[model samples]
Target: MTDHGPTREELPFPDYDHLPITGLAHRIRSLDLAQLRVVIEYEEAHARRVPALQVLQTRASELEAGAEPSGGDPSALAPELSPAPSAGSSVSPATAPGPDIPPTESDEAKPPMRG
Candidate 1:
């Protein structure tokens, strides 16, 4: 929790903590070994999530094996965070049921009260 290094806001993936595990896999493809290391350290200091660590370690391995950093934009909006077309809520007045009405006190059809 102490000042380990670059703050979460200063890391390659500034929104790392908020990002989903699946999204993280794609986003990390753009980070170089050094940037990825910083993120790994930050993750260990904070959440230390196993899945995230796995993804990061896998990328590090790839980098060590001569795999180049992906050409995708690291600063691009995460697919998970992007607004999906026609993804709004389906609820509307047309789908809602009509309001219920209470019975009047003078109604003759009222049933007798239970004991």
Candidate 2:
């Protein structure tokens, strides 16, 4: 709790960079004031994610104003990534080869020089 060097991954919120506003709203309800403050500062320095930041700041204020932390069900949260398309919606690599496409084994496919 007192550790000062918290990173985005270390935050209680999963996928902090990508959590939806709704998910953030639900998750932050369980964090104590100190935790909420850390989230706010992390968001500000990283993406400056306004919606999540506003939600967290507001909750932190509520706690400062004497509200108690209401622990929420962390397991119920869903990932921000959308569900993958079912089988037919995607093209299999084995079936999609084109004559113009270079072979993956060729030296020409090597990555460009970075230096």
Reference-based lDDT, residue 74, model 2: 45
TM-score of model 2 relative to the true fold? 0.59
User: Candidate 2's residue-wise lDDT over 42-93, tens digit each?
Assistant: 8777777777778888898899999988867543456655655676645677
User: Which stretches of candidate 2 lie above 4 Å from their native place?
Assistant: 1-5, 73-76, 79-115
| Top candidate (lDDT) | 1
Where in model 1 is the C-alpha error above 4 Å?
A: 1-3, 82-115
List TM-scores for all candidates, in order. 0.67, 0.59
Candidate achieving the largest TM-score: 1
Q: Which ten residues in a row have the lowest lDDT in candidate 2?
A: 73-82
